[model samples]
Target: MNKEALKKKLFTEIYDTHWLKLYLHLLKMLDDEDDAKDVVQEVFASLWNNFDAISIHTSFTSYLYSSVRNRAINYLAHKKVVISYEKAEELRDVNFSNAPDIFLIEKELAFQINSEIDNLPPKMAAIFKKSRLENKSYREIAEELDIAENTVKKQISRALHLLRQKFIHIKYYLFFL
Candidate 1:
C-alpha cells in the first residue's frame, strides 16, 4: 500500500477499534468529560504527527491509554497549586465561624494523617504519594521509580498496613480520653 493509504488505513482501524474505549478510560481518570475529549484529540494528533515513524508492533490502545494518563496527571498537577490556594482561602473564611471547633478537628485529623504518612519507609512513602496525591497508576509509579509494578503495589500495601496499625493505636488512645 502507498504511504497515504497505509496511514489512512491505520487511522481508520485505530479509531474504529479503540477510540471510544480510550476516551472512556481517560474520562474515568480525569473525571471530566471535556478534558478526556481533549486528551483523545491530542493522542490522535500525536499519532498523526508521528505517523511516519509509527511501528506496527506498537499496541495503539496501550499508547493511547498511557498518553492520556500522562496528560491527565499533568493537568491535575497544574491544578493542585490552584486548588491549594483556594482551599487556604476557604479555610481562612471559615476560621471565625460557629463551627470553628469542627474545623480544628478536621485540621488535626489532616495533620495526623500527614504524620503517619511521613513515618512510612522512604520508597513506600514516595510510591504512596505518587499513587494517592499525584493520582498516578502503579505502572506509572513503577516506571518513574525504576522498579517493578508489583513492587510499587506491594509498597503501597505495606504503607497502608502501617497506617492502619498507627490509626488503631491512635483510636485506642482516644478511647482513654
Candidate 2:
C-alpha cells in the first residue's frame, strides 16, 4: 500500500482502536498523565512520518509503547539536569566565611561536581540528582522514574563512584592543608 493509505489505515485501525491502551501504557511507564498523552501524540506523529518504512510485521503497538518509553525517559533525564544546574547555582550563592583560598577551592569542587554530572549517562544523572541533591528516597525516585528501587540505588551508587574517581584530586588537595 501507498504511504498515505497505510498512514490512514494505521491511524484509523491502531489509533482509534488502541489509543487509550497506548496512553495508559505510557502513563504506567511515565507515571504522569500529561506526559503519557504527549508521548503518545509524538509516537503517532512519528508513525505518520515514517509510515512508508515501517514493516507491517512489526507490532505497531509495541513500537508505540517503546517510543513513548524512550521519550519519557529522555524528558525525565533533561529535567534532572536542569534541576541539578539550578541547585548548583543556588549553592554558589551561599556565603562562606572561610579564607579566599578556601572559598575558591569550594567553588572549584562544586564546578567539578557539576561537570561530572553533565557527563553522566542520562538515567544515571537523573538518579544521582534525585537521590543526592533532592534527598528523595530511593522508593520515591524509583516510582517517579518508573524503575525498580534496586535500579535507582545502583545508579546512584555508580554515579557516586564515577564522581569520586573524577574528583579524586580534591581529596589530595585537602590532605595537603
Candidate 3:
C-alpha cells in the first residue's frame, strides 16, 4: 500500500483505539473539556505531520502518551503564562521527567554500537556479530570458527562489556534504547 493509505490506516486505528483514552487523560489532568479536546487534536495533528518519519520504539499507545505529555506540558506552560503572567521558569517543577525521545536515540546508538563492534578485535567482533546479527548460537559460532563454546561465550561477554562501557551514559534509558 501507498504511504497515503498507510497514513489513513494508522490515523483511523489510533483515533479509534486511543482517542477517548487520550482525551479523558487530558481532561483529568487539565480539567477542561475544551482544552482536553484541543490538546488531543494537537497531538493527532503532530502525529499526522510526522507520520512518515516517526518511529515507534514502544507501543503506539506509549508513543502517543509521550507526545501527549510533552504537548500537554507546553499547553499548560503557555496557559500559566497567559493566566498568571508568570515566567516559564516558575513552572519548572512540573513532572515532565518521564518522556525521553527514545526512537532516534535508539537508532543512533545502534549505529554507533554497530560501528564499534565492527572495530572490535577481529575474532571477538566476528563472534559477537554472528551471535547478534546472524542469530547464531554459541555452539554454532564456535563450530564455524573452530573455537570452544566457553571461548565463544567469553569473547561475546567481553565484547558486550566494552560496548556497555562505551555507551554507559544511556544505561538509564536501556528499556527503550
Candidate 4:
C-alpha cells in the first residue's frame, strides 16, 4: 500500500481496537456519559491529526489511555474556568455602574485581540478563525480547506504565538495566552 493508505489503515485498526475501551475508561473517570464521549472523540481526533509525528515509547494502548486521561483532565479544568467566569460575570452585573472602567478595559482587550487576529497572514488567519470562532476541529478544517491537518494545526499555533507576543503586556488576560 501507498504510505497514505497504510497510514489510514493503521489508524482504522487503532480506532477499532481502542475506541470503545477508551470511551468506557473515560466514562468511569468522568461519570458523565456525554462528557466521556466528547473526550474520547477529541483524543482520537488529536491522534489522527498528529499521527505521523507521534512516537510510541510504549504500547499503543498505553499511549491512547494516557491521551484520554489528559484530555479528561483538561476538559474538567475548562469546566472550572467557565464556572468561575460565570460567577465573575454575575458579580460584575451586580455592580455594573461601579465597574464601568473594567467593562471598557474588556472591550478594548477584545478589540485588540480581533485586530491582531486579522493582522495574521491570510491563510493562518482563516484557519485560526475556523478553528476558534467556528469551533471546528483541526480535521474538519483541513478537510474543508483541502489541506493537511498538520498545516491547520501549525497555522493555528503560529497565530496564537503571534497573538501572545502582541498581548504579552496584558497579563490579566492570560486565559487567551
Among these predictions, the greatest lDDT belongs to 4
Q: Residue 102 lDDT in model 2?
A: 78
Tens digits of per-residue lDDT for model 1, 1-177: 897998899788987887799889988888889988887888788888888886755776676777778877887887898899999989767654745575666689789999889888887888999999999999999999899999999999999888888788667754443
TM-score, cand. 1 vs. native: 0.43
Residues 46-75, candidate 2, lDDT per residue (tens digit)? 777777677755676666667777887887
Give the 10-residue window scoring lowest on summed lDDT in candidate 2.
Answer: 91-100
Candidate 4: which stretches are off by over 4 Å?
A: 97-177
* Per-residue lDDT of model 4, residues 11-89, tens digit only: 9998899989998999999999999999999998999999999999998888889999999999999999999999999
| Candidate 2 wrongly placed segments (more than 4 Å) | 1-6, 93-177
RMSD of each: 14.6, 17.4, 16.3, 16.8
lDDT winner between 1 and 3, please give it. 3
- Backbone clashes, candidate 2: 0
Ranking by TM-score: 4, 3, 2, 1
Q: Ten residues in a row with the worst lDDT in model 3?
A: 90-99
The lDDT for every candidate, in the order shown, is 0.83, 0.82, 0.86, 0.91
Q: List the candidates ranked by lDDT, beginning with the highest.
A: 4, 3, 1, 2
